[model samples]
Every structure is written in structure tokens, then in C-alpha cells.
Target: MTTARDTILARLGSPDGDPAAEHAALRRDYLHEHHPDVDLVELFAERLADYQAVVHLVPEGELPRALSRALWEGGYVIPDGVPEEWVSGIEPSRRAGADTDLTAVAGVITGCAAAIAETGTIVLDHGPGQGRRALTLVPDHHLVVVTADRISADVPGALALLDATRPLTFVSGPSATSDIELSRVEGVHGPRTLEVFLT
Candidate 1:
């Protein structure tokens, strides 16, 4: 049976090409940083927007009000460890975490361990305020709160803030995919809406 690699090898007239050597060559050393002087929070907001996420940047003291206004429609629940005051006006009845069934919940709010500006990704290590992976995933909407100090300038910087052995969940955007015909669909595997509050 002719595989894609075999077909490429045949076209290159190198049927004896070594796959292992090709793999090694592709694993070359790479850059670990970029734009050291650029504003990471700004970059993070821009990248997050690019992924179709609604990002809000608010001053530290204004978080509660900002959070209340964003979720005023009342369709979200806060995960464990998410400071009570952050979702104060949103109604405590909605908050739930740790082994809760989130499938029917409109959204779940939680804090993140670190955020990567370069990739616009939020990493959750199930830390204090961040709940289990399922808490953020099963719900159709995710409201994430990120502190300024948690936003890293690059992937390398973000990695440096994480513990290697912990269970890590990196969310780039609302779960979405395109079919073979190029039609796009969302919420196929995770939340279809991601609202981020970057403090």
C-alpha cells in the first residue's frame, strides 16, 4: 500500500529516504522568545479577540462591577476558589464546582494559572480558584478571570509559571472546527463562548 510519505518519496525520486532522519531534521532548535519590549497584556487581549473571545480589561478595584455587568443576564456559575466578591452581584445560587454536572449550566467562571500572550492561550492547572478540567469544558460558556501578573509575554514565560506534574488544560478559544467542506461549527467539544476578564 502506498502511503502519503511513500508518494512524496516517489515524487522526489528518493524511495530510500530515511523517515527517522527527516523527523530529526524537523525537530531543530527553535526560538523561545519574541518582542521583549512589547506590551504583553495588550498582545494577550488582541490574540484573545482574534480567537473570537470577548475580553474585558478592567482596573483591579472595578472587577466586581465589570463582572456583574458582563454576566448580568444571569446564566453563569462560579467555580470553587473564584473569590466570592468577584461574582457577588451575580447570585451565589449559580456558583458550583468540584464534581458538579456542568452540562446544563449556561457558563462557569474560574481563575486561571497563567495566560500566554503569544498564543492567546489560558492555562489552568486546577489551582486554588480554578476547578477541575471538566468545570471549564462541559459548560457551553466559560468566564475566566485573569490577573495582570498571570499574563505572560510568551509561551516560554507562561511555561515557567506552571508546575510540570499538575493536570494542565490550555484553552485557546471556544471549541470549534471546520468540516471538510470548510463550514465552521462551534461548541463541538467545549464551550462555545469564552468571556475573559483580564485584570
Candidate 2:
């Protein structure tokens, strides 16, 4: 009997073949065939919003102010780590980073590691520069900032750039669930609202 590893290897075709070249060619063919006219970022935004996520576009220089305004409008108390420059126009109460309870927060604004356009997914790895995972997960609303350069065309391309060792969260849209009756409900497991800001 063939071992599982041997079976998998056989199923993947001959080992003598250039795996990288074969995979690249396959990806190219698949994308051209199925996603010929896709404007990756636009498609991603459309899908995200279709899933009830609010999408916003802002200039790079205006990012901080936009974030502050979004937070204020969403009724969140600002945390200290959030730059004062960003919160300049907003009138929300300010608290130290340690003082803010995530559950009580109406929204949390964060920078994403990257976004995969084909699947309309945003990736978050809790790196020190990116902020804590709890900040994004515990809040009712998540406002993610994704620069144009950080957007990828599809899952395969996105995965190629991601670090496998890190704890990663992939979000396609808002948290949702379906009841036994087949009724669909939103905001069950995570953020009820997922807002994406593309710069």
C-alpha cells in the first residue's frame, strides 16, 4: 500500500518537473481564464461591501485624520497609541492605551498586513508594529487601512508573501452566522462591522 506522502506526491505529478514553473503557469492560466477583466482592488472592494463591509478610499497624507473622523463617527473613545494628529478633528474622549477596554470600544482602527483582492480578504498578523490582535477582534467594528501596494491579486499570490509561522487572521467581511432554521445573522463571532479604507 502506498503511504499518504507517496500518494500525495504522485497526485502532484512527477517530481522531476519544475514545481515552481508549473505552479506559476497554472496560476497564470487560471487567472486569465476566470478573472480576465478583474480590477483586483475594485473587485475586492465590491465583494467586501457586498458582505456588508463599508469601504472607504483616502489619500495617504490624509489617513490619520480620516481614521480619527471614522472613529469619532463610530462612537469610539480614542486610545493614546492613536496619534493625536489623527484625532485632531474628532471630539471623542481620550484614554491611555491600558485604560481602554476593547469590549467597550465601538470600533478599532488598524493597519492590515495585506489584502487579497481575488478573495476580498484582509490579512492581519499581530506584529509589534501592527498592534495587538485583541484590538481588532474584540471591537464591534474594525476599520482596516490597506494601502494600494499591499493589495494582492489572489489567495496564492497572497500566501506566497505571508509568513507561515505568525498568528494570522484573515477577514473577508463582517462576522456572521446561520441559525439551525437557516436564518442568517451578522456580527456573531467577531466584529459586526468591517470597514476597509484603501489608500
Each candidate's root-mean-square deviation in Å?
A: 7.0, 4.9
Q: Pick by lDDT: which candidate is best?
A: 1
For model 2, the stretches where C-alpha displacement exceeds 4 angstroms are: 1-37, 72-92, 95-99
What C-alpha lDDT, on a 0 to 100 scale, does residue 106 get in candidate 2?
77
If scored against the real structure, what TM-score would every candidate get?
0.80, 0.73
Best by TM-score: 1
Model 2 residue 15 lDDT? 68
**Model 1 per-residue lDDT tens digits across residues 16-108:** 787666655664366766868888899999999999999998887788878777653435656667887777766566555455566656777
RMSD of 2: 4.9
lDDT of each: 0.82, 0.72
What candidate 1 gets wrong by more than 4 Å, as runs, is 1-30, 72-75, 97-99
